[model samples]
Target: MQVEVISSVNEACSGKLQHRTAIVVDVLRATTTIATALAAGASCVIPAETVQDAKQLTKEGDLAGGDRFCRQISGFSYGNSPGQYRGKQIEGKRIILTTSNGTRALCKAMRADHIIAASLLNAEACAQLAWELRRDVVILCAGSRDSFALEDGLCAGLLVHCLRQHDRSGMLQVDDFGSAMEALYRNKANVIMETLAQSQTGKKLLRLGQREDIVSCSQINVLQAVPYLNGGSLIQRLPGTIAQTAAPLC
Candidate 1:
């Protein structure tokens, strides 16, 4: 198996991810929120790259969740916070999710053989599912806009660590972004919290009084389901369930 990490969605095109198993990361909030929703029993999540797209999907009969900058858009039912998705009955429903960065990354990876939405919340489950599928994996980080975000990179490193631990025979490849992720994980205790607290996007969240989101997104493996994108919908693959499934289609 081979592992590659791309920093932004713009760098990941259909040709680049063709026939490859892709893992999408947006740990600051979007991916984390999705994992939480699935863990809380959402039937599936349909990622939309734009808010307009999300609204259109809703008009066509999909439940819509609009998240802009950590806040729910006016007239939308939910924001990007994982806390909001909890304890709600979302089973047997389809969520049309649009976020600032994460959903766009999912849209970009739609052409991959296997596309899984991942975050620190479900890092271990994502890695385990990847190993079960036994395909070369590409970890794509949805950086803040077109630039890097420490939170997403750190989550990518955690996924790398999980994959390396479970499948030692596989080859691991780190890109510039992946190397930065490894470095960030190495010094997480000292720099991550403070750096995030001061980051441009992070500060905006702070001003919005969502400091708890930062804390929640940083925890590793709080969710047990690996949210995989299949046929334009996101499905959760519980641990010990993939082995019974068919071989990866790609």
Candidate 2:
């Protein structure tokens, strides 16, 4: 397997993304929010790069939602918070979402053969899909404001850790940066809370009084909802996945 990490949306746009499986990580919120919505039984999640594009897709009564710079848009029903999606009403509903960075990364990575939203909420499932597909993989981190964000990198590293743990063949080749990310995850797995609380994006959220989102996004392996892009929208692939409430990481 050949695996690499694209540290920011700019890098994703500049990369040759064809014939690859992209695991998009926006751990501060976007990817985490998608996972929770899918786990709550949303029919599909449509990612848009702009607020106009997100609103235009409401033809089928798709719920328009998103945020820009940590502030919810004025007309949207919900912001980019994981807690907002853990509801029974979300079932059978399609969400048209746009975000400051995460959705833009997703749009940039659209050329890949497969695109999946991932976070600590569904790290193992994302890894399992990557191994099963056996495609060239790109762990694309949705960095904030065209620069790197620690939480996304940490989640990418978590995916790398799980992939390495599951692969006994020792044949997978990871680039130096990927290896360093994996090492970072291995070394700091015990201090996830502090690590997240002190991260740049996390601090921004903290200032906005959105502390619950930080805590909610920190839990690991709690959701089986793997949100994969299919036909311009992301839907949960839950054929035989475990259905249960999310739990905190160890």
lDDT of 2 at 145: 93
Sequence-dependent TM-score of model 2: 0.93
lDDT of 1 by residue, 81-183 (tens): 8777777566666778999889999988887888899987888889888877767788988888688777777778877778778866546665666666766
Alpha-carbon lDDT of model 2: 0.86
Best by lDDT: 2
For all candidates in order, the CA lDDT equals: 0.79, 0.86
Q: What digit string (tens of lDDT, one per residue) describes model 2 on residues 5-44?
A: 9888878753557888898999989999999888888888
What TM-score would every model get versus the actual structure? 0.89, 0.93
In terms of lDDT, model 1 sits at 0.79
